[model samples]
Target: MRGAAMSLSAAASGFVVFLLSVSVVQGQDDWGVTYTSTEICALKGSTVDISCTYRYPSRINDHITQVKEKFWFTRVSNNDYVDIRSDPEYSGRVQYIFGNNDCTLRITDLRESDSAEYKLRFITNQHNGKYTGSPGVTLSVTGMVTDLQVQVSRLLVYKSYNRAELKCHSSCRLPDHLHYVWYKNRQKMWRGTSSYSVSVYPADSYSCAVEGYEKFPSPPVYAPRVPSVSVSPSGEIVEGSSVTLTCSSDANPAANYTWYKENEVSPKASGQIFTITDFRPEHSGNYYCEAQNRRGRHNSTLHLIVVAGKFLHSATHILYQKS
Candidate 1:
């Protein structure tokens, strides 16, 4: 009976060893690395995180030991690789999140130069136990721009006054923590929110910009407003006299001025001021000044009459004949 009991115990121990060997073989066959995302897109001046998980056999050739080192790299040359954390370009911007079987790389203040392929490598204490994940994540960094939209209230406040609403937007949904800024005629008018409301006025010009990037504001937009015309002489225009017409308007980026005559398809002059030296009778016509910008355009008209020298003399002779 004692011999039989010892034999049974030895057979059970052998069975357990056989099962352990099979388990080790299965784990080794499944050793590999996988990334959460093969490709990732990030905005310039923003932050991004790349994640990965790795697995390895617990025992290789009956050798079991702790992992010696792990790191991330972009290139491998001549059997040598440089860790991204040690690279000068990523000195302050890169951070590593490491775990027993998982790792993550975080990059902040991203720039176009940060775009690259990133791979993770690990080495174990066992001799010649090093593995690198091939075809790693690809990172793409792009610039962010502000977009501005204008909306008008359908209902008027006082039966004739409508309010204009300006909203700031971006291509990618930005964090709600970020604040917005509003500008009119290059002067800051509002801040703290993405939307701003104001009394509608044709003469007002407006634009939107982000808080950190005030210098690069969105293109200005303005509702068309009638241009104001002023003559240099400030009186009746006479023939053979030099005359100058100045056009002014309240427009974002300032309005471009163009002078046109009635029945003419083409503009007679282009600029804020139009000058006609030695004015002639043919110059007498209905003139209009057009103020335009990227937002819209407006026109204001003025009738310019030039009296010939001969007409004044004829009028004086008629008065003498009547006397």
Candidate 2:
């Protein structure tokens, strides 16, 4: 149901060179099955449908060769096949669409493991009458995160803003005219092309998705947000007491925290949490933490004032800004 409208595109865009596979007809046109498409390429988390039609003689040997049962399968051993609907891996996600002489297999919430050769089989009421479609359809479920990516090319970088071009790239070759949907901060933007260009800020994140399969968007590419710092002991700092300073920032690919004191040429620490075992006047300077990633960096400064033994103020003051 996720891609009810995209079923045709999903089924058609298997590959540039299409191959037709069908169940070979028996002698004298007694029985046969014809598949709609031999291959399908669909998004990892979307739904797909594989359809086929079959034919068989109405009467044989003075007895009717009526169809008894029909199902789809992906595996076989010693001439035994298990229906995909009964498989635990496909529980509640597999369905069969049926019409006169036509049957379609619908699988929702598809996974990478679902990529396999799928075949349609039917059993007739006649003795030893069983037919399985030959050369089953091959399904390829591609993951959006790895298969699709946003390529960033910076055009200009200034102190206030940045201008860049973002391109939606796919490892698998897709159709040239496939529509693309751009997203900023997880919201849809007014652009629908393979490439997008816009002005971006340090806090903005961007992603893209194929039209109709918006649920499986590519991983967001973003710079670090403004960092924030907090003191573990939220009380009056006493002399010789341990105090921990923690910094955090929201970012894609995660941000690394580095602690530094004001006017220091080198970093004081290399983690999110920095602890001062003995709180004293020397540690009362302006301390700050820098959160950095591949995209950009930000910092938060904390002013710590330590009196001789007790407090001038109970709470610490934190200042956050872009760096």
Largest TM-score belongs to which candidate? Answer: 2
- In the predicted model 2, the residue pairs found to clash are none
TM of each candidate vs. truth: 0.43, 0.54
CA lDDT of each prediction against the hidden true structure: 0.64, 0.75
Question: Scored by Cα lDDT, where does model 2 land?
Answer: 0.75
Please provide, for model 2 over 1-323, each residue's C-alpha lDDT reduced to its tens digit, 9 standing for 90 to 100.
01111233343223221223443332225676777767777666666778777777788899988899999999976878999988999998888987887888888777889999998899999887888887777888876535578877655666777787888987554555568889999999855788998887887889998776687788998877777788867768777788899898888758898999998889999999999887777777888888876567788888778665753333334455553
What candidate 1 gets wrong by more than 4 Å, as runs, is: 1-48, 54-68, 108-112, 123-167, 172-175, 184-187, 195-206, 220-323
Candidate 1 worst ten-residue window by lDDT: 314-323
lDDT by residue for model 1 over 141-221, one digit each (tens)? 656454444333232333333455566665444445567788877689888777777764555667777677676687776
Candidate 1 Cα lDDT to native? 0.64
For model 2, the stretches where C-alpha displacement exceeds 4 angstroms are 1-74, 80-114, 117-139, 142-156, 165-177, 185-197, 218-221, 310-320
By summed lDDT, the worst window of 10 consecutive residues in model 2 runs over 1-10
